[model samples]
Target: MNSLKLPDIAAQKLLHVTPLDWVGMCAIALPIQLEGRHVAAMADAGVNLVDGKSRGIHMSRLYLALEQLEHQALTPLAIHQLLADFLASHEGLSTAAHLRLSFEHLLKRPALVSPLAGWKSYQVSVDARLENEMFHVELSVRVPYSSTCPCSAALARQLIQRQFEADFSGEVLNRESVLAWLGSSQGIVATPHSQRSQASVQLRLRNNLDTVPVTELIDAVEASLGTAVQTAVKRADEQAFALANGQNLMFCEDAARRIHQALRELDIATAFTLRVEHAESLHAHDAVASSQWQW
Candidate 1:
């Protein structure tokens, strides 16, 4: 009888292994700092199979690499290098690498009147791919705004005018009094529908650059809509918000076009996909419109 010693898997170098079509980890939870703010990010990483003949990848190595890069700010350049490092670590096992990172981006916005508003959270995702030694990056963001019904505003005005003429049939028509009445509660009795809406934007960067300020895009969208929905409110802020809703009354089509025009004016027209979803208050289902430019 003879005793045999087994080789250590952790210390021994992996050899003669076939390439994998895909290998790596997914849903890896880690803390990441974006724009000098620390946030939690769920990252997914994988690489294309090498030769279709391999047992499995060193999953622990993938985890460690991600942990090492977790605190580093994720810019376009950093992402490219990270992907390259991930592939190189597994050597011969994969050629192309893919990584997806999703997190909640907190944005601090000022109220229409109130001071020192808290931060608002937006859902954001970043996707990157490395193929043939070229890197590609895409950033996506979800923003919430307010949409008012245009038809409702117009119809209310018409009804108020008719009621005014009927109520003052026997009295002498004084322009000043009539105008005051019209501006009063009785003059504009219209049912206005307000919907909480969301806009999702995805931008593909040229030369694998991901430094495009996502917050700026979100701000532009909120500005284009004229107002963002408020989470916390006071009396003054509420009144200001009401004024905004009344002034910026829009249809679903108007919302979509506004966003499209905003993106176009920014000169990043050819590098993005835009999706606007209005969760309607007047209807049970949502109204959605999407468009993209070719580049």
Candidate 2:
């Protein structure tokens, strides 16, 4: 039996038709392949509704074109092709297309001093836009690390010295005594406050790359910060992490500069912006710093 004709509200023309800058679906749940594994992702697919005369854009067509991305590996070529498909599907209705996918990129990471390894999740975003036949791509990642305040370290050292003087008052300092005291809790009384921090980086990838350099970018940010938060850790690994934090003391400004310098050396990035947030334990408010280059 033929289905009864239904009213089509989407196709109904308005009395005053006006153009929309952007119109489409957002936060759509979809499974996408990244690298060789399947990862669940959310996509924001849309196009510029430039056809004012038309009642509205064919939203289902835009969605169908985006559905093709479900089976394809997420890459620069795939993203560019998907955007082209978006425009092609819109035909005369759209002059620009944009797609954004957000997902967690997981990688296996080895402990600093242990044989154990564990999976690490990185918040990743792949954004692409095609306007006037010009294509562009951007990659963003969030990395967590440890930040030790330099000022706190200095204050802690001062307190430790005073404690040591009180413990060994009017006594000649001896090597064995000092060593014993250093090994004991009394010898190392004060500790600098260190807190968890994160660096959020966005890079305008050069069009010459075959795929996103997610590992390289994460490595650079970790290297710059120097005390990346760990997954699996033995006692030795914990000690090593503590030592790293002590050696890599930094303020928020310092963290920002380090990340900025590291990203500047990478050739994959045509331009970049970075933000470092030190979730300060000493204060209720967090300390933050940001830097950008090449716009």
Candidate 3:
């Protein structure tokens, strides 16, 4: 038997040494454990090529390290450990490691006033970094809701009032007649415009937490907005949703403020940035507002 030597090209010295900030892979598909479920996720795994003399980082090591997320529930500690593994594998070749995972989180939501329920998916991403022995993690989520324009509602109410005055100009006003008129399409000539809206938030978590409060954060945002989009609905649920929209009229700015206050009260994150986007049915352009705290 003959012993053959294998070539190690990555270990070879470079003629012009230059350290790269980041090097590895992006959009690596994998299954990850989240909230007791196996979720399909994509990851961006990389490490800083701190060793200028080295040709490149061992990218295979970074890909193999992602296996830790397969069965274990995602948490701050798990992400921290994964980043540590990246650094440990690279040793002297890398000084810092980074990981980003993107996935849709499924939640079963009950109808507003029915026993029926359906699944809703929220766009979520987890970003983590390990540098100078410090570990940092950020959690982001996009929540879809419904927003009714306050100005439009007010305008609709004015039109309805004028129509009422015109309808009963000479006739005697009575509860039955008024009720019938209110139920007729002629009575309510205009209706407020409502559109689907989205709230995107990024939170920098405090280092002391063991678990990520993803559901709790989503709940807070939905509760604050008060008009989250429904999945499955009966007529009763639809009516209730309409009532919710009627009572919770808001502009993009108002939605942003509501979310900002709610997340601040949660106190789970040291800093956060949030943006609310209203896909306005009244205008051709979208309405958007952004807010941040200690970020």
Candidate 4:
């Protein structure tokens, strides 16, 4: 076997002498430790090519640096160090480093009124950047909830009231008779329309935070909506969920406002943007609303 020097084309000079904004790889499959759980994740790693005279950046260096994420828990400090390593590897060729990690975070959710519980998956992403000695992290999550149309609920109540008046117009109203009638399907003529909805929240985290508040943020959003979808439900839990939907009727706009207000009160993020999407069962199209604060 003969040892030959490999060609260093990336180090060669470029005739165009043009600098690139971002140069690296995307959708790199990897495993990361987050919140004490080992998560299967995909990463997008890149850096801004500041040196115009160079032909291209060393892509292999960025890929190698991402290995650090596998060993340590994902945090602001861990991401900060990763970006530092990216710039260090590229040295003069690059100045700014950017990394985006996408994964499904599994969380155990309990039934509304039952002891049963099951695992739910939430789509989560973390975007990090370090430029000009400044660092910022953005956390994004997608949550699914149930949204009942308020207008539909009001109309259904109106129809039910009219039916009740017609049924007991000339009869003496008694507790047992009314209870039996109310339990009958014919008594409740109409029901409100509800659809599965999703809330997507993007938060720009405070620089001083030590850890990412993913679970806390999710709890706040779910609490505000009050109709989060359930798993492994019993009869009692289903009935409770139905009652919750009836009590917490909302439109897309209402859902967005609720999430916005909840995020505003939280201290985790300096800025945030939220979007609520209702997959309308009444129509073929989906209803959507978006809101933002300091962003």
Candidate 2 per-residue C-alpha lDDT over 10-51 given as tens digits, one digit per residue, 9 for 90 to 100 = 677678768888998999898988777788889999999888
Question: Candidate 3's residue-wise lDDT over 198-292, tens digit each?
Answer: 99999999877767778989999999999999999999999999999999999999999999999999978999999999998988999999999
lDDT of each: 0.79, 0.89, 0.94, 0.94
Q: After superposition, how far is residue 29 of candidate 4 from its true place, in Å?
A: 1.8
Point out the worst 10-residue segment of candidate 3 by lDDT. Answer: 205-214
Between prediction 1 and prediction 4, which has the larger lDDT? 4
lDDT of 4 by residue, 1-295 (tens): 7699889998899788788999999999999988888899999999999899998988899999999989988888899999999999999999999999999989999998888999999999999999999999999999999999999999999999999999999999999999998999879999999999999999999977767778989999999999999999999999999999988999999999999999999999999999999999999999999999999
Q: Locate the minimum summed-lDDT window of 10 residues in model 1.
A: 10-19
lDDT of 3: 0.94
Question: Clashes in candidate 1: how many?
Answer: 7
Higher-TM-score candidate of 2 and 3? 3
Arranged by lDDT with the best first, the candidates are 4, 3, 2, 1
Candidate 4 deviant stretches above 4 angstroms: 1-3
> What tens-digit string does per-residue lDDT give for candidate 1 at 79-139?
8888888888778777888889998898777778888486799999989899888787888
